[model samples]
Target: MLKRIATALWGKFESTAELKKFGFLAAIFGFIIGTYWTLRPMKDSIFNAIVGMDYLPWAKMLSLVVIFPLVIAYSKLIDKYPRHKVFYILISIYACASLLFCVAFLNATLGLVNTVQSPWRLIGWAWYVFVESFGSLIVALFWAFTTDTTKPDSAKRGFPIIVLFGQVGNILGPLLLNARRLGFANSAPVVAICAGLMVFSGLLFCKIT
Candidate 1:
């Protein structure tokens, strides 16, 4: 019975090994994409709250300015090192940055730092820049890894299923946020959760074969 459902949903594989591999890769890809999607709304909301909708154009432009050079550097790194190593470096940096922001924002919420002041606004701007840049790069790397790892045949069958998982993540992220409105109210915990998802997805990425 379950086999029928599995086959109906994911299609049949020639062997158990193929089935397992397809599921594994699909899961990793889905989580990676989902994690990024989750951050999308959070970042947008925080940017709107901190700087107002009027300033979003300027923030996006600034994000492009910051991301362009980093993208070039990342492309060069891909040429110089193994892709997995590059993934590790990038994800680690993102995770650490998230943790730092989590701490900073938490302090601000607790009155350890003044959030209604100049430096706080500056920090919010920086967060907006990082979020925009990271969103583009992470999604690009995920698809790149997907193409690199998936056989053409498997990808044709499996990519859609993987994307479905990502869609679930996309739906789930916002629902989770809505449920945790208190976290979203401040932005710090939201950033922390996004960071944790990135780290978790990175671990899963490492395990992909």
Candidate 2:
């Protein structure tokens, strides 16, 4: 019964080894991409809620300003380090940033930090820019890794399944963030979960030997 399902889903590969390889890559890439998509919406929500609708245009402009230097630095990193090492650095930064924001959001909710005031609003604006850059950079790096590791022929057979799995992640990501049902009515837990996912994705990247 399971075999039939596997065959139907993946189609028959030329060898069992090839099938296993494709399945593993698909699962890893899917999880990473999906987790990313989940955080994408949350980022927007955070910015809008904390920074106000009027400030969003300014935030967008600020993000554009930040992205250029980041892109240049990322290009330099790529030139200097191995791809996997660069991925580690990127994910580590993301994990740390997520954790930092988790704390900030929690404090804001608890009235430990004033959301209406200067520093907190400034932090929110910075976060919005950082997340925008993080999403674009990490997703691009992931696909570059995918293309590097996958043979052209194998990619033809396997990339669609990988994307399919990622779409499932995209679906699940938003559902988990639903305010009422999962009880993620606060931002801290959501940010923490995203941090966990980022860590998990990093571990999976390490496993891609």
Per-model TM-score on C-alpha atoms = 0.85, 0.87
After superposing all C-alphas onto the true structure, candidate 1 shows an RMSD in angstroms of 2.9
- lDDT at residue 34 of model 1 (Cα atoms): 65
- Checking candidate 2 for backbone clashes, the offending pairs are none
Candidate 2 RMSD computed on C-alpha atoms after optimal superposition onto the true structure: 2.6
lDDT of 1 at 71: 95
In model 1, where do residues sit more than 4 Å from their true spots? 1-4, 109-120, 179-185
Residue-level error in angstroms, candidate 2, position 175: 0.6
Q: Name the regions of candidate 2 deviating beyond 4 angstroms.
A: 1-11, 109-120
User: Best candidate per TM-score, number?
Assistant: 2
Evaluate model 1: give its TM-score. 0.85
For 26-141, candidate 1 gives per-residue lDDT tens digits of 67666666666666776766666555567778888888899999999989988998777788889889989988877866674532245343334765677788888787787787
Please state the error at residue 152 of candidate 2 in Å.
1.0
